[model samples]
Each structure stands twice: as C-alpha cells, then as structure tokens.
Target: MSDYILGSHQPLAASYPLALVDLDGVAYKGHLPIEYAAESLVSARNSGLALVFVTNNASREPEDVAGQLTGLDIPTSPHEVMTAAQACARLLRSHVQPGAKVLVVGGAGLLTAVQAEGYTVVSSTDDEPDAVAQGFHPSLGWEHLAEGAYAVSRGAIHVASNLDLSLPTARGYAPGNGALVGAVQAATGVKPFSAGKPSPAMYDMALEKAGVSSALVVGDRLDTDLAGARAGGYHGLHVLTGVNSARDDILALPQERPHFIARDLRGLLETQPEVTRENEWFICNDARVRILDGALNIDSAGEPDELDIVRASCNAVWSFVDEGGEFDNTSIPHFSTL
Candidate 1:
C-alpha cells in the first residue's frame, strides 16, 4: 500500500458555506479558547457563514459544549453544535423504542444525552439493558468494560460515540472513547456501531440543524474532522495548534487530508484563495511546504521556534481579519522575525 495518499482537489467554489470547528484541540482543549480561536469564530459568524462546533468529545452534551464556548466569549447556541453524543443518541432513538434500557459506559454527559433522547439509562449494577452506549471518560473501570461486553453479548445494540483511539491534552496524548470500545470488543468479540466524527450521520445532523450548504470542517486531528469532511463532501481545514503537528502526520493520512492548513482556528477564518500568500507563512516551517500561489508554505510549523511564531501570527491575523482587512500580503515579512 502507498504510504502517501494525495487527497482529491476540491476547488473553493465547491466548498460549503458552513464551518465545523472541533473544540478539543482546534478551538480549545477544554472550556478556554486556544489563543485566537474565539476571535476566529466571531469572524466566521460575521462573514454570514453558519458555524457549528463539531466535536468527538463525548464527555459533554451539546448544551454544555455551547455554554462552555459562550462562557469563553465565543458566541454559540446549543443548536449550533453537533457532538458524538448527539449522534449516538439519534442512532439509538432510530433503532430502539423510546425508554429502551441502555447500559451506558462513559461520562455523565453521555448518560444524560442518551436519557434526553428518551432512552432509559441503566447501570452495570442493574439488570442487563437492551442496548449499550459507549462514551469515553477518565474514570472508566474494568468493571464497566465487563458490563458493556455482557450487554452486547446478550444481543444489545452497541452504539459508540466515537472511535478516536487517542485524545490531545495539555499533559500529552491520552486514550479516548475508542479505547473503551476496544476493551468491550475484546471481551465480547463484537464491534460497535460508531456515531461520531468521520461518520456521515454526525455531519448530516449538523447540516440539518444549521440548514446550510457545504461546510468547512476545522479540526486538530486529521483522522476525524478531515475524514468526516471528506465523507460529507465538505472542505476541511487542519489546524496545527491541536493534535497532529507535522507535515508527515498529514502526508500519511488515510482518508481525510485538509484542503487548507492553518495555525489554528484564527488562521482558518483568515483563509481565502486571495489571501493564500499571506497564509503561506503559517506553515512555512512545515516539512511539506507545498507551493501554493508560488509561495513556500509548510503543512505546520512544528519546530520549537516556528510553533511560537505560528501561535503569535495566528493571534495577529485574527485581529486583522476581525478588523476587515482584505487579505493584505504585508504580514509575511514580519512573521519571519519570530
């Protein structure tokens, strides 16, 4: 098999008017905005594009995720978000009757989201449920894994919020929802139906909620957001501030590679075909600095010095974009100083 898979070229005209920004590494790791992420969202909204915060973090519900963004000064409503939890809930509701007992193995958010969807939540200590919903959380135990396996072995529908094996964190990489799903599958020898990023169901829900055509999916991880965008026929923008940070990381991507590469959410908002030259500096230090508009730009500034420059430039570009600058090419020289 080929190590590198070049993505199909998607022109700007084919891009969507909606923007899907991942919260966990793209916009913010938790509740706080990662540098210029808040400003970027504001700019996208002002541009008349519908913005949806699409995340694979099953630990929080849509309302909670929206509230977290709003608290961080990023304007968002619960309806303006799509989450793995919501997808799992919708999938369950479609397959099972309302109030069907579901054994939940994840976070409180997953439990609450399933219940909100009219499914009756059950615990491992309770009788075996009619379905099993798996979401990732830090406190998952071996006992819960056994229960999930038991429930699935009993012929319960197994719905996984996402299949992301790892999650980005300030501390470092950590196992995610997919880890728990793996444990259950190992025990029961059954794979689950995933309803998260990279799944068309989640994107369909988001588009339906936003009532928009085409979308720009922004994410830190290439595996999920980018994959989902490709499957859903949307443009994808990969940000370096979140998870994967090198050109090699993206060059080796399986199904989803970004149509645009940015330093963060801020860089994406400033992204335009006309502004391609200005944006080229953001990824200049990346190993795979491709020639776009005769400019040498890297996939991501992964070096120590370049990382700092990317962050600072992302912040400044966000400010300029917010102020209505028309994609001037002046900032390229200044970014080189960092």
Candidate 2:
C-alpha cells in the first residue's frame, strides 16, 4: 500500500466523522481501563468525532457497558453502544419466524435482545425452539453448551454472537464466545451462522445508526476487528493496547491488515506519518527497514519511536508479501518502547 495509507493532513479525529471502536481490548482489559483509552476518546469526541462502543461481547447489557465506560470517565450512554447479542438477535429474525421460540445460551444482554426482537426466549430445548442463539457468558459451563447441542441436534437453527476464540481482559485472554460455540458445534455437527465482527452486519447497523459515511473502526484483534473494517469498506486503526501486537501486524494476512497502526488510543489525536519506500528500503520518518534475502533488517541503528520502526517494517513486509516474496517472520524483532 502507498502513503495514501499515511494521509496525515489532519488528525484522525477530524478526518473521520465517527469511530466504531471495539470494547474488549481497546477500551479496557477485563474491567480495568487501558491507559489513554478514556482520555483519548474524550478528546476525540471534543474534536467532532462521534464515538460508538461496538463489541462482540454478548454477555453484558449495553447499559452496563455504558456504565463501565462512564465510570472510567468516558461519558457514554446505552444508545452509543452496540453488542453482539443485539446483532445475533437481529440476524436470527431472517432464519426464523417472528416470536419464534429461541433457546438462548448467554446472559442478560442476549436474552434482552432476543426478547426485544419478539423472540420467545427459552432456556430449555424442550420448548422445541426454532433456533439456538449462543453468546459469551462468564458463567456458561458444560450444561449451557449441552443445551445448545441438544437444541441444534433436534433441528433448531444454530446462531453465534461472534466467533472470537479468545476474550481479552485484565486477567488475560480467556476462551471467548467462539470456543463455547465450538463445543456446541462439535457435539451437534452443526455450523453456526455468526452475527458479529468479521461479518459486515454489525458495521452496517452501526454506520446506519451513526448516520455517517466516514468512520474509523478502532480495534485490537486483527481477525474480527480489522477484517470487519476491510469487508465493510471502512478505514481501520489497530491499536497495540489490546490483543494483537506490532509483530502481529507485520505478519497479518491481506484482509486483516490495518489501514493504520498505533500504540494506543492516543493515535487518534495525531496524523499517521507517511511510510515511503526507496529502492528496497521502506522509510517512515527516521525509521527504515528493508526485506532482503528473506529477512527484515533495520536500516538505521538509533532507536526511533518503537511504533515508527513498526510502521516502516509493516509496509516493507506487506510490500514483500504482495510481490510473492517470502520471508522468515522470526527475522522481525519485537518492539518494547511505547
């Protein structure tokens, strides 16, 4: 990609009228707020960028998610949040009839969403549910999954809130909704129709709700967040504060590579720097990297901002891959300074 990926005449806050931000990794790790997440978002809003907390987490109600963000000092309301539960419920409508009996295996968020959509939510498959909706819930265990398996095996349509295998939090990355969905799928031999990130359905809904064309999808995970942004034709900003790292970005697949990469939400305040390639060298300000003989090499010795080196190397590696060039990912060094 050219420096069109590096357009920086203005800050991202001014360039995009809205920001569809991910929740798990971008806003907080577990329950604790990630550094700069709150303040930076506040600043983005002050600068005219509308903010919406878009998440694949289907366990928590939007009201609770909003409360958490507000407690962290990033003033928010339930209307400004969208959850996978809501997305999955809306998706279920297309597969089943109105007020269809649905076996819900999640938390309050999923149940409420299904109820709002006029689905008859039932905990047991004995209700002969028309569909089984699965989402992430901290308390979900073998029994919950078995219910889904039973429902699907009995001819109920299977639905998943998201396919994220791991959930990011302060404790660490835990098995996410995808893992649970996997158990149910494995038991029933049924593939679920997922309704969250990596699918443009959620983004389409959020964009319509925000009523804007130009929006940036800010996130941590590449597979869901970045992939969704690409599929939806929205510019994506991958932040290092969450699940994926600088190393992950360097080796990302074409559809999952971010339009911009930064250390944290603070990236919203500044314009991304241009990354220019000269001969075999990809240069970003004072930092430069080159891919030669299937290895990544730093062209300059002194340390540039760690992110600068990352920016340079990502462009270099991506360019290499684009041309059918292959390289050992191990040749890329890890960056520490944020």
lDDT of each: 0.69, 0.90
Over 84-121, each residue of candidate 1 has an lDDT whose tens digit, in order, gives 88788888976689888999988878888898899888
Q: Best by TM-score, which number?
A: 2
Lowest-scoring 10 consecutive residues by lDDT in candidate 2? 1-10
Per residue, candidate 2 scores C-alpha lDDT tens digits across 1-338 of 64224647689998988999998789888889889999999999999899989999999899999999999999999999999999999999889987899999999999999999998988898889999999999999999999899999999999999999998878788888999999998898999999999997888898899887768999999999999998888889999888888899989998898989888999999888988878988888889889989899997677678788888888888888888998788998867674
Model 1, TM vs. native? 0.74
Error of 1 at 35 (Å): 1.7
In model 2, the Cα lDDT at residue 264 comes to 91
Off by over 4 Å in 2: 2-5
The whole-model C-alpha lDDT of candidate 2 against the native structure comes to 0.90
